[model samples]
Target: MRWIAHIIVNAVLLLALAGYFQSIHLSGIGAALVASFLLSVLNIVVKPVLILLTLPVTVLTFGLFLFVINAITLWLTSWLMGDLFTIDGFGAALFASLAISLFHMVIDAISNND
Candidate 1:
């Protein structure tokens, strides 16, 4: 239900990112969907541990280090997806994470209004 909608939205956002950046490459909608699912799983499982382990750095950076954590997650997603979904470099991964975050915020806000 809600999770399906979120995954679809994330897939759409991934496609949008591919269109927006030359460095971001998505093989197709299928790859985007797989990447989206993997990203969500990583966020749920790996992100918490990462946030806990990096609490000091995150606190020192005033929570900004979360962005780096997100970028790492994105990079991991790309690595896991291999050729299916590829981000050129750390810069591309960072930018893609920011774009995805912004899109997710907007989507969540819109959904919450309904």
Candidate 2:
């Protein structure tokens, strides 16, 4: 299903980011998978509330504030993951969130995930 594809893609993206960014450290594919799953869960449960709460800022910023919300979610994931998946700080999380968002956007478009 779409969910499986999204998880797999996000895991791959996490691995790729870990490779490219010294600030983001991932233990292995297993960690990536777990992080990916947790991120999916957070997106489903937490992201909506974040979006709603930040609607004014989001709209004011022309929807760019969503990236900040995504960064917060990534930071939360890193916290939940402890040592297995670590991002240096909000800067790294924000960068990773942007990269992940770009990749997901591409994947969604190609797969007609709408």
Candidate 3:
């Protein structure tokens, strides 16, 4: 199902983030899985709300503010899933978001279309 693919992609993204960013800590596959779930939820809910609230700044910055939105989601996921995962600081969160986004892009490319 699409939802399964969704979760798998998110898990892979989280794994890639953990590998790429030293400040992100995932104890094991289990922790990465849990972190992926929280990150997906944060992306689905919190990200849109933050984007809407920061629309003016986002527009002014030519969409660069989306990076901040993404970082906030990373930080939020870290906070909500602290028992399972950990991120050092805003800089780490920012890099994690970037790494995750890039990983997601690669996964999406390889998945079956439509």
Q: Give each model's whole-structure lDDT.
A: 0.93, 0.95, 0.79
Candidate 2 displacement at residue 77 in angstroms:
0.3
What TM-score would candidate 2 get against the native?
Answer: 0.94
How many backbone collisions does model 2 have?
0
Distance from true location, Cα of 4 in model 1, Å: 1.2
Report the lDDT tens digits of candidate 2 across residue range 18-99: 9999999999999999999999999999999999999999999999999999999999999999999999999999999999
How close to the true structure is residue 109 of candidate 1, measured as C-alpha lDDT? 95
> Higher lDDT: candidate 1 or 2?
2
Clashing pairs in 3: none
| Model 1, runs deviating above 4 Å | none
All candidates: TM-score: 0.94, 0.94, 0.84
Report the number of clashing residue pairs per model: 0, 0, 0
Q: How well is each residue in 1-114 modelled by candidate 1, as lDDT tens digits? A: 888888898899999989988999999999999999999999999999999999999999999889899999999999999999999999999988888788878877987898
How much does each candidate deviate from the true structure in C-alpha RMSD? 1.1, 1.7, 2.1
- Which 10 successive residues of model 3 have the least lDDT summed? 105-114
TM-score, predicted candidate 3 vs. hidden true structure: 0.84
